[model samples]
Target: MNLVPLAAEHVSGHALLPFSVYAADGRLLLPAHAPLADVRVQAKLGRQQALFVQRADHDAWRRGLARAVDKVMQSNASLSQLAQARPDPVPPVQAPLPGEEWEHVVLALDRAVQAARRDVGWVRAVQDVQAQMRAMVCRRVDEALFYFIHTGSRRTALYSSRQALRCMLIAGEAARELGWSEERIAVLDKAALTMNVASWQLQDELVCHVGPIVDEQQRAKIDRHPAEGAWWLRHSGVTDPAWLEAVQLHHDDSLAARAPSSLTPGQEMAHLLRRVDRYSAMLSRRAGREALSATQAAQQACLGTDGKPDPTGSLMLKAVGLYPPGCFVRLASRETGIVLARGERANAPVVAALLNAEGASMAEPRLRFTTQAKHAVCTAVSPGLVHVDPPLDRMQALHVYLKSNGPAA
Candidate 1:
């Protein structure tokens, strides 16, 4: 979609807007006919920084010039139009570069999350960043999982923020599957985003700290982060009790045999958060420790120490699939590939073959539907074992959207 820059007059105090407003980077700022009442929203457009409207709005005000030109031609008066006017050229609005949001959003989100930790006034800022990330996740869930999952391991600099965002996305995916209300999901997303707020900096530090943790203080902080994080959120003006409770109880590994459907909303949401948080942590490499493969991580998340299956974990698999996107796998035919999307069944996923049966890189990744016997997944494989560095952006853009602006059906 094309965009045009807006001046202050374009959006005045509390007026119902005629057109939707967007950030300079294409994020929606204010919807059509909505009042611009939030101080934080106005601040984004201040300092002469650019805010935008759809190009059609600009064209609407420009069409009058065209009408006057037509009127002069209809009059048949020679030299009546006077000297030719030299108009000052107005520059065209630029579009965001391809994959710019996906590439930049991770860093942008990290900054927002870190800023929020320092100041309690950054509520809207953090939520705004989360909304943009959630849009990307909802738009292309598999691509999002692939983008963050791959980035999450390669760089531990922003592990705390990246892991939290990944967990929020996973919760949203599962929540959508369970047919939860949008309002309920919003609360879940917020809780997931801030579950580790109390030890965010510590999380990033731990990721790069090699060997056994000799820091007893840091070890104790990790053990009590859940309750402490909830308290921090309360001081930050988080009013939703359920949201706080979810964050507080996020580490309740003691949940035994409790079904998701029977649990209270807060407990259910917390259980979902716990399942995703632990699942993502296993995939992200910690210091000298190698990350667990997707299969190993899933087994840990889904099964208890006694080998009993957790019902909510079962719900996660049903929602996100057995071998979710971003994990590498070996097909029955000996070809190695990356899972691109979850298929109808847990075992069958949409895969792109990176290496041939002979373990050589293919000229291009070949998309395979693992439902077919010839293409069924044989086992999970490590990223180091796959010889090719997957072209994530190109492969992501190749996905066919079944809807106008969302994941495929």
Candidate 2:
């Protein structure tokens, strides 16, 4: 597959031998006119008298070699320059830790639920136990999230493990804002964790196929599993009845009615569970459903089943801004940034500008804090169109900016 230079004087007018010629080392020297057996060839690069029949004239060979050499040199220069470049750092923002008392409760809940799921003997006790467990967990979850306000935006932080972590953080923030106690935060965290567990039971395929298929054959297997998942929770030795019910009822809101087994308490958890569960599901990118920007998702969430945007959803958007921290957004300022922190004011969400309109890196990020009266109220604009994979890696890069800024103005 190697090429060699040749003298124009070496070959005469068109002959019919195999047009291709290879050197003794199997390096192709020239394309020959005759077939391989009849074609004579010579290798110009190697020392041996390797014979070759002509394909291109000597002038054409020289021009090609020059072009190739030029390309290599240009590529090397660009790579070297890129290697030496220094980029500006994004600012950091602070997020409060989950309270100590609540943290222990979440740890215990996770441990108990995980252990019970593994123990077959506890299966029959599962429903009774999970129901109580989920209620306690739900209460604690309410407490943990009490500090930060809850909004309806698609504004979400991305991470696999952070699915649990972020849910706890946001929920804890919400609970604290609602005047929840430490125990309440723990309950909410547990509820969040349990809801995730229920979703996992549906297997991978169903969760992904949230497509528009109306036929019975398509819907048959889909309807039963959500209820079945609840049953599994009970059988698995989950001691808390509320947690069991939360798992069971989480899906109830999606369908027509709760199962006959569903109790009044279970019905309550089901409603709250759906909000948290669906919020989680929407935030995470799935297979068939188009992944939405945190803003877009929030918009859609605001537009409830009635097909009108929900007022609460607007509040969520306003609260989170159009883009929450860890979201990728295209700014009206003609820059593309990732939300590093939420603004204290409803309108401004802090951002770490990543790129200019020309898709070049910004020299230095312009921090936007909504709390400052001087800063114009920057609204949460639409998100940019970039597919985010391995969301956690991006979050690491984004966190620095978030930690430095206060809540949006």
Candidate 3:
């Protein structure tokens, strides 16, 4: 039977009894009668460090549950032994920001990634489909950047897809800027995803580094994951030698090397991937460090005289744009909203402000051409300023606000 674990609170109208069975050797695999009030059998089970549904559908999960029960009976555990208090209620979801479609798309893709990670078939399909999708996004980004190089447009286009997609887009943009063709782009895309596969190999403490203080040496070791990650990728049957080579040399600083030298097209693309990966890491809401602003990032980029970002900041700006769309901003009236669209005008596309800092509905969003408004100003409030994480619920609130307030006039 295929069954995935459904959250306990979600369990309803089903009459379940605590029962157990024994094995041929008369050994207890799981307790027989789990006390309904003592030890709780949560709907979740850790399958390879990732949670899997042990009772949702009617396939493997159900079979696993039955097997577990059989083990319990053989062990001679009583029903009361499995009883425990229900887990605490999950925290409320945050509302989405007004006009933040891209964030919503990215969040949805995160759910897809989680699902794919749980199912092997889905994982394979994700990799295959995302490879092609990555190429498309990369080509698009290159075109956009080429336009920027000519027109000096302040705005840029951004797409939110799986990690593979993100990597592809970043690598492709760099490749195109450097004039690499379709074949080279494929090599870069392969390297980008494989370089980070074993990211799951690191423990949470190491991944998060949630200790008292991490010394410089430890930090350096953690930073070497790309090199280690590449080794793992190569071992995993990644056939693209050029891709693996790029991955290994991505973080190395031997500008003067042997095999094609360090600054070759493939190596340069890999270097760009390294920067994008670092930028993605910082974008995540990690504890301890304050998030940086785009303007701050731009300044940081200036600090590096390498014609690229001083140390890897420019690609982020190139990827996300100087003023990223969906970015939340406060108006002159102190109203809050996210960017809704991009425009060719010197300033302004469209914005949909939903609230005031005090948590009041905006009087109404007044659409002013960012360039034509009395004072088109943007405050540099970093994402860290908000304690609550942005989510769909937040956007629903803005949707309600918009439905009530009508268009930004």
- Candidates' TM-scores? 0.74, 0.49, 0.50
In model 1, where do residues sit more than 4 Å from their true spots? 1-99, 257-262, 305-308, 400-409
Better of 1 and 3 by TM-score: 1
After best superposition, candidate 2 residue 344: deviation in angstroms? 1.1
On the 0 to 100 scale, the lDDT of residue 390 in model 3 is 33
Across 1-409, the per-residue lDDT of candidate 2 in tens digits comes to 2235343333332232223445444334443443323334322323445554233433344454456456656677576554433222212222224233334443444444445457654333323333443443342322222211111122222222234444545544444554557664555555555455533433344444566756675465456545655676556545566656665666664532445345454454455445544454455554454345664566555457776645434434544445556555566656666555555544466555656668777556555444454443334343335422213334333443343222334
Off by over 4 Å in 3: 1-126, 132-183, 201-224, 254-262, 305-319, 331-333, 340-350, 356-369, 375-377, 387-409
lDDT scores for all predictions? 0.74, 0.45, 0.45
Give residue 234's error in model 2 in angstroms: 2.5
Native-referenced Cα lDDT, model 1: 0.74
- Candidate 3, residues 96-187, lDDT tens digits: the string is 34334333433444344344334434334435654545433331332222222211111112212333345555556556555678787777
* Best first by TM-score, ranked: 1, 3, 2
User: Candidate 2: minimum summed lDDT over ten consecutive residues — where?
Assistant: 143-152
- Higher-scoring candidate on lDDT, 1 or 3: 1
List per-candidate RMSD values in Å. Answer: 10.7, 22.5, 16.7
Where model 2 places Cα greater than 4 Å from the true spot, the runs are 1-171, 196-203, 206-222, 254-268, 305-322, 363-366, 370-384, 387-409
Tens-digit lDDT track of model 1 for 118-211: 7886666667877777666654777777767766655576788789878887888899889999889988988888888878888888889898
